[model samples]
Structures are given as C-alpha cells and as structure tokens.
Target: MSTAPVFAGPDAAVPRHVAIIMDGNGRWAKRRLLPRAAGHRAGVEAVRRVTRAARALGIEALTLYAFSSENWRRPAEEIGDLMGLLRLFIRSDLAEFQRENVRLRILGDYRRFPTDVVTLIDDALARTAANTGPSLAIALNYGAQAELTRAARRLAERLPPEQIDEAAIEGELETRELPPLDLLIRTSGEHRLSNFLLWQAAYAELLFVDTLWPDFGADELSAAVADFGQRQRRFGGL
Candidate 1:
C-alpha cells in the first residue's frame, strides 16, 4: 500500500479556485507544549509555502480563511499576535507578489478591521491590482451568514418587488466575480464549514486532512491536488 500521497498525478486536474480552511493551530501548539502564539507563527509560514506552491502550479485563484468574525472571542493577546503576523506578512510579501506578478486582495468586511490594518490592506491591494498573476484572497473578519444577509439587504434597498431572481442575488454576492470553487481543503481534520464561502463552495470537492495548519506545507498541498485530479466532478449528476 502507498503510505504517502502522490504530489503529481496524471488523473488530477489543476483547480482554478481553491479555498482552504486553516484550522488547528492551538491544538498543534498544545501538543508540542509550546505557546499558542508559536503555532500561529508557524501557520503563517505554512501560508507562505502554500501560496508559493499554488502560484508555481499555475492555479488561478487561492482563497484562505484567515480570520472569521467569531475569532474575536479568542483571547486578546492571541488576536494581537494574529494581527501582528498579518501585518508582517503584508509588508514582507509585497515584493514577493511583485516578483511573481501576483495580485493580492482582501475578502471580507473592511469596517470591522482596525483602521491602520485596513489602510495597510488597501494599500497592498492597490499596489498589486495590476499584477497579471494568480489572485490570492485572504478572508478577514468574514462570516458567510453576514455576507449573505448584507447582499440581500443591498438588493432590498436597491429594488422593489419586481426583480428578485437567482441571478440578481448572485450578482449581489461578494464573490460574484470569482470562479466557482473547484476544491475546498480543511486542515486539522475538522469536517465542518465553520461558516466559510458558503455560497461559492456548493459543489467543490472537499478534502479533510489530519495535518494541522502549522504542519501543512508544499507537499501537503501538492498531495491534495493529486487527490483532486483523481476525482470526477459530477456537480449534481453523474
């Protein structure tokens, strides 16, 4: 029996849109008898690795669930650490993005983030907008229910009772411009959406791995893609 997953397989097709549920940093730290902040720092490294790998593989779009609105419930210190890491990543990754021609975008409620952090995000996005490479979207303070509700409210405020249709609702969605998800992977083995890109990932092939975010690397991502290549996407019917 093959114990390790194959990184490249002829059966696997490259995904155009891939979303990741980055989970299990805390658990990973606890297991090592290290501080939770350590795990978070390690997870950030994993993010860099996966992004580079995806770009190298010529993936069109990569979306990461960085921080959800519910994450505010965590300790203030941890939040601070996360925000610090985010800031560092943005400042340092800009050159890498320019080199790779990658366009960086933040997907979520900007109002909920700190003013300074929001400013940094905006600047980073603007600077990379013209890049002709892969689009890397980071979800911060995002909630699927909140996104859907906001979309619906916008529609209600703009139109009366005559133009309600699937296309209308979809047009109102935040992810209207992005392609439908081809694969959704969750690290740390928790098989739940946790309120991610609910509308977009409707029929995406899901892969749940036992590895934690900190442990996930280029090899792990490649293996997931290899698995994706083996599956025949039927959408609804075979």
Candidate 2:
C-alpha cells in the first residue's frame, strides 16, 4: 500500500462529507487470539465514536463501508455474527439517532438480505426520515461495480439512447441524495477502493491509516481531518 504525503498548507478546511472503510476487525481479533466475532463486536464501538465525531465536526454527511458485497465469501458463522451485530445496532441505536436528529440511510442492495434485516433497515429509515442532523449512510452488501451496472441498466430501461449522460447516471446513484463525497479514509493501512463508492469517490481525497477499526477514535479522526486540510485539490488544473 502506498502512503500519501501530508503537506501542511496555510489553509486547512474540514470536508463537508467524509467516508470511511472500516477495516482490520478480523486482524485485530486474530492478533489477540480471539474469535473474529470479537473484532466485529469491538468495531461497533468505533462506529459510534466516529459517528459522534463527524457530527461534532459539523460534517454534512458520513458514509461508512460497513459491509461489502464480497463479504459474503466469509464463513457462514461470521456472517451470522455480523448480521446479529447489525440487528443489535439498529435496534438499540435507532431511538438515540432519532433523538439526536441523525438520519439513517442504507446504501446497498438490501433486497438480498434476510427479511428481518431488511425490515429493520426500512424501519430505521422511516423512523429517522425527518432527522435534520448529519446523515449517516451505511454501505451494506454494496459493491461499486454492481451499483454502476445497476444504474446503467436502470438508465437503459427508462431513457432513450440520446437522453443518457453522466448527469443522468449520477442522479440514479444511491448517493445522489447526499452531498458529494469529500474524503475517504480506510483504516488498517489498506490502500485500495475494494469496490466501495467507485463513482462517488471519483475525486475524493484518500487517506489510509494504520490504526485498526476497533482502535479508531476521535484522535485519529482529528488527525485525518487535519491531513485533509493540508492538501490542495486542483482537480484537473494547476
């Protein structure tokens, strides 16, 4: 994995939107000689911490790559454990999130999920729909390639040949309702996209950190934002 240099610029700005690829849960547990499920359970605490941090930072939106489509390749027991965690998280936190005016959005093909999990997701969305605070989007069972392909198919089905364009496809994306992705941070020192938010992250600043997801806290978050502030984004120009 390649590391990007952090330059201290005179202007430091907090991105409006932040996304994180929370990695290293399994490794963390393996290192401790515990079951991988322990790592996943610990990762849940990090999620709560990061979500609170983002809101405190005045971020407009935060998207977490909670579960990728490829995650299904894991052992059945592990997947069941993750599903249980998801259930517990939504069931326990939905009320607190609503109380804090935090909106909950799921950003993946949830139809493939079990009926009960899908119901919880739907219920969470409905309950928090009126929230006006920072929006938290969890990418569950999401793969950017699949997302793009689905978007393309949807466009082809509805629009004539001449009517299709980048704008049309962008509008059809799951992230269309949220602000543009500004910064994408991957924990556990990984430096790849891993099929998460491919289209939305076209121009996002990438930050790969060595900290495991379970250990990620406000300090790490602050550092990432600080690093983000130091860089210059020229887009396509000098």
Global lDDT of each candidate: 0.86, 0.89
Under the 3 Å rule for N, CA and C atoms, how many clashes does model 1 have?
3
Q: Each candidate's root-mean-square deviation in Å?
A: 5.7, 4.3
Give the alpha carbon lDDT tens digit for every residue of 121-197 in model 1.
Answer: 88988999999878898899998899989988998998886887767877877666666678899999999999998
Clashes of each: 3, 0
Deviation in angstroms for 157 in model 1?
Answer: 1.9
- Summed over model 2, clashes come to 0
lDDT tens string, model 2, 49-83?
Answer: 99989888888899999999999999999999999
Report how far off residue 40 is in candidate 2 (Å): 0.2
TM-score of each model, paired residue for residue = 0.92, 0.94
Error of 2 at 69 (Å): 0.8
